[model samples]
Structures are given as C-alpha cells and as structure tokens.
Target: MIATNEKLLLDALPQPVISIGSNRHVTYANFAAQEFFGSSLNVLRRQHIVDVLPFGSPVISLVERCLDNSLSFNEYGIDLTPPTQIGGTNNGRMVDLHVTPTEHEEGNRQALIVVQPRSIANHIDRQLTHRGAARSVSAMSAMLAHEIKNPLSGIKGAAQLLEGDAGPDGVELTRLICSETERITGLVDQFEQFTETHADINSPVNVHAVLE
Candidate 1:
C-alpha cells in the first residue's frame, strides 16, 4: 500500500507523471497520468510504456537513453499522439518531456517521465498578443478622433455660416466644403466605433457592395 503522504503528494501535482521500469513497463502512474491517458492505475500498470505512447516515438529512445546513462534529459515541443484511446477520443498534443533515472529498491534503474502540454500555454500567449494589439489600435484611433474631429467640427460650422451671404459660385463652394466636411466626420465616427472595445454587434457587410 502506498503511504498516505506519498500518494497525496503525487496526486497533488498538476502535470501527468509516470515511472518506467527496466523492462520499459509502467511501474507507477500518478493520478494526473491516469487522467491524461484516460485509464485507471490498474489498467495503466498492465501496459508497457510503448502502449501508452505512439509507436516508434522518439520519447521511447530518450527514455532508454536516460535509463542506460543514469542521467536526465529534457525535450521541448514534442508532438505526441497516443496510439490508443480509452473512450474513443484522441488528439495530438505538443508537450515537453522530462526524463530522470532513479535507482529502484532492487538496484535496477527506473525512469520518471513528466509530460507537460503546450497547447494551453500557446493559446494564452496568442490571447495576450491579440489583446495588446487591439488596445494599441484603439488608443491610436481615439487620439485621432479627438484631434481631427474637434477641428473638423469648427470648419464645418464656418462653412455653413458662409453659405447664406455667398453668391451662386461662392454658395456652391461653401456647399461643397460642408458636404466634404460631413463625409470626413462620418468617416471619423466610423473610426471611433471601430476603436470602441464594447461595440454593438455589427451586421455582416457585403464585400461586393464595399468594393463598388
């Protein structure tokens, strides 16, 4: 029977870990490993290291090397695909493997392997980068809207004031100025909406209409 303290410690770990005997058979698999492999301890203990891992995987070679050399090895960004599934679900994952060899009670070498998946890590990195870029764009758009739109409002008001006193040609010129200013301000409003973080759900735009 495993000591309470030892079992508790192993189960408390966040990452999956397994120990391989000299025969490359699994001697011990932690709670995380059972969850990762989708198997119980009894089931996992009956299987060999090769059974859980994909056939002809480099990790097997690394395990052998570690056991033979009595040294530790770390491999990063290893793409792993399990050979079999416990409940008809299996997906490939990127992981970092750490192998450490230790002496057993009978003087044989047992290798410990830690499996750390990188999918969650990669996702968090992408999310952070995306949010950072969004914030930067939003700040730039807000600054432009404040600086340009304020002066643009004054120009639009002056053009409207000139429209009544101007002659036909001057009236046309003022009208042109007012129309152009309105168009520019409309563009600035769109930019402001684009920069808003909590924007309303936008309707799908037609690519053909936009292009035309």
Candidate 2:
C-alpha cells in the first residue's frame, strides 16, 4: 500500500518524473514527463528509458551510476532531445536531473528521476552582455566631454577679457566667441544627461513590456 501511495505521489509532481526498474524499463512516467519527451505515458510504459534518451546523454550515465551503486545521483547539464514536432530550435536543452533508489513491494530495484530545465545561467549571461555595452558607451561619452569642455571655457574667457580692453573694435568677435561657447556647452549638457539618466535606478517594471 505504501509503495502504491508513493507511486501516486511521484506521478503527482509537476516536474517531469519517471521510475525505472532494474531491467531499465520505464515503469512509470508522470504527465509532465510525457509532454517533455513528446510521447504519451502509455507509449513509454515498459519501454527502456534509454530508448527515449540519447545513449550518450549525461542523464543516461547518471541513471546507470545510480542503479549500479544503489546510491543517488544529482547532475546538471543533462541534455535530452525534444521530439521534432515540438518545434524545439536547439538540438536539446540543459536540465538538472536527480536519481534516487527506491524500494518496491515486489523487491525489484527501482529508481526515481526528477527533472528541471536550466534557465538562470542563460538569463544572467544576456544581462551581463547588455550592461557591458552600456558601460562602454558611457565611458566614451565621458571622455569626449572632458576633452572638449576645458578648451571651450578658456576660449570664451579670453574673448571676454579682450572685449573689455578693445572698446568697440572686437565686439563682434567677442559675441561670436560667446555664441560658440554656448553651443558647445549645450552639447556637453546633452552628454551629461545621458550619464545622469542611467544612474543606478531601482524601480520595479514589467520586464516583458520594457523589452517590447
């Protein structure tokens, strides 16, 4: 009765779960397992687990180790082929699988396998690439601002001093100097806005909408 209840509980898990017998036959597969492998549970029942999974897959080797030593095996990077009709772009995806020995009423050696897809590492990699590009652009803008700002300020100040000494002779040149300085200052202000706008803001936002 306990073994039967265990089987029911195993089948109830949301993640893909399977039970393999000593003969390496798939004794049980949950609904999620059927969907993930793109086959019905009835079709997989009594079939060898290796028949569905590639022979060279890490998951296959892990299951073999668990059955051989009667010990549990936990591994990441198990690659399994999705059925062609499922529209999977990649040949396979990375997953974490755990296998543990379980005792049955019939005294047959069996193992329980639980599977979870790996996603967090890929997400982190994408975010890091985006931030690296943003940082490079910010650094270049800052360098340009620093290189041009000081020389423009000196030219404007010298023009003002010359105007004070030249009476009416250099009024037009002084006015031109002030206008050019203001134009350069406006450009510098625009660059400053870019650096300021991206300053470590932490606000909750719908990421999907932001991406769109």
lDDT against the true structure, each candidate = 0.83, 0.76
How do all models score by TM-score?
Answer: 0.53, 0.52
For lDDT, the strongest prediction is 1
Clashes of each: 0, 0
lDDT of 1 by residue, 106-142 (tens): 7888888889978787757856988899899999888
Kindly report which residue pairs in candidate 1 clash with one another.
Answer: none
Compose the digit string of candidate 2's lDDT tens values, residues 1-212: 12667668867888998888788888888888888777787888857866867666666666777888899988877766654433455455667888998776777777788888778786467569879899888888877887788889999898988888776758888978889898988889777668634356579999999899
Please give the lDDT score at residue 109 for candidate 1: 88
Runs of candidate 2 exceeding 4 Å displacement? 1-3, 83-87, 120-212
> Can you give the lDDT of residue 200 in candidate 1?
78
